[model samples]
Target: MLLLKWSAMGDVVIATALFEDIAQAFPGREIHLNTLPVWEGLFVEDSRFSSVFAVDLRARQGQMQRIVEWLQRVRAGHYDLVIDLQCNDRSRLLLSLLWLVGCHIPYRLGNRRQFPYNIAPAELPKPVHTMTRCRAALEAGGISATTPRPVLSLPQFNHARVDRLMKAHELREGHYAVFMPGCNAKGYLKRWGAARYAALANRFHEDGLVRIVLIGGADEVDECQAIAETCGEWLVNLCGQTEIFDIPLLCQPARLIVANDTGGAHLASVSTTPMLVICGPTDPRRVKPLGDNVVTLQADLPCINCYRKTCSHHSCMSMLTPDRVWQRVQKLVQEAA
Candidate 1:
């Protein structure tokens, strides 16, 4: 079977869970996943798949050429089925190209119907987990999954890098909580206010229970710094310090993770660490972290779960106060202990 799921780190991680369910359901089938180049590292040593095809979607000049080449490669292997986990225009275009190249796959499955496609649509039984949505897609192709949850497995990285980070931040083992206070700058509405995160950090610091380690991309450095300034000396703002791959490692050793609805929250879900995820605009039921240990704090406002790119008012996020988040965090920490 051929599985297609492209970029956006959080979605990619969510797609991986579907792959896990597919692998479990069809142990003998050769599973090949198609994803963007940057996200290939996230699935480096995956034992479930026969191979992973990393496509560079950004290369404009050779776009059709590469598609033709990939089609030829897929046709030669004679895949029995094609699953478009990413039900977007690009995936539809790729599948159309595959058909044009005489690669007649019996079944093609996805979550949505957008293109003038001839594939069977997977119908979900109920409003289930995102991971279950993937499993439902596989079930549409006559595959049955025993496990409904997504599972992620990564390689053992050299601890030297983590040790260096710990030393630089003066972090004692089991004494710090990782705080990812920023989302994609483009989706500013998804981020909780920096001041509120600072207030939460200060509250945690006052209790002497946890030190906050700020984590995010270089673009988020300013916001992280702003929170650090408010929290004073206890906050270790490592916003621009680590690579994408280092995030899971950083979260793996943390006491807890307090993050917005971003890739960090997904990483925290994959780890054994307990996490308190603050949701805004996005529906917690649909997009929250896929784990039992996760606790999501979302505002009760009707405008929440809007899923809109532009909002007239961000009361959905603004209404989720520091105290509300702190209560959830405190509960998670207490339960974890």
Candidate 2:
């Protein structure tokens, strides 16, 4: 079986959850995954996959020659089945190219094509979690999904690396809370203000119940600094300090994580950390992290879950006050304890 999904880190993580179901359902079948070059490291130690193909879609630069070359390489594999989890025009085009090459797989599973393709489309349930949706698609293709949680096993992460990070950050052992204050480029409004995060961090710090570690990408450095300024000496800014692959390991020591609707939030959920996800335009029901200990705080605004790209008035997140999130944090901390 060949699985095609590339880029957008969180979505890839969500898709990984269906691997166990696919493996169990097709025991002898070899599962090869096609993903972006950057994510190759993330799946290096994942035993669920037989091999990983790192496709450099960006470098192809819309060149027909490069596309054909890559397509030829993929067609050479003679896959028994092709599962298009990405479910976009590019993926559909690739599937079409595969069909043109006479690599006739008994089944080709993907979203309903907006245009047309050789294989019939499988319609997935709407407004459901992407992970669950992917699992459902696998089920449609005869795979039974058992593990609902996203699977991420990294053998490269050793205690020495963990200890080094801890020592570098002066992180104390025990129950700590992580504060993630940034989203990816798309979901800016989902993030709470730095002051609000600072207030929450101060509350946890003053209570001496939880140490707050701030994590985010380089774009979030300003927000991280702003929170640190208001948080005084209690906060540790790990934003831009660690690589994307290092985040799961960094979050391993934390008991609970408070984050925006971001990749880190999803990572925190898969790390066995109790998580409180602050959401805005995105619906908590649709995209919130899937785990027993995961909770979400969203304003009861009528316009919430709109999935808008830009909002002139972000009252949805603005109204989700720090106190409300603090209450949720308190609950999660208690549950963790």
Per-model TM-score on C-alpha atoms: 0.86, 0.90
Model 1 TM-score?
A: 0.86
Q: Model 1: per-residue lDDT, tens digit, 180-277?
A: 99988888888888999998888878878557899998668888988988777778888988866567778777888899988877866767688888
- In candidate 2, what are the lDDT values of residues 1-337, reduced to their tens digit? 7888885777777776766667777778888988988888878888888899876776747668667766876787788778878777788877777677786676687656443233333665577666666666666656676775667775565445767877866786655678899887666787888888888888878877446888999778888999988876557788888766567677767866888988877766667777888988888777887677788888888898998989888899789778888888778878877
The deviation in Å at residue 16 for candidate 2 is: 1.3
The candidate maximizing lDDT is: 1
Off by over 4 Å in 2: 58-60, 111-125, 157-159, 335-337
Q: What is the C-alpha RMSD of each candidate to the true structure, in Å?
A: 3.0, 2.6
For each predicted model, how many residue pairs clash, with residues at least 3 apart or on different chains? 0, 0
- The C-alpha lDDT values of all candidates are 0.77, 0.76
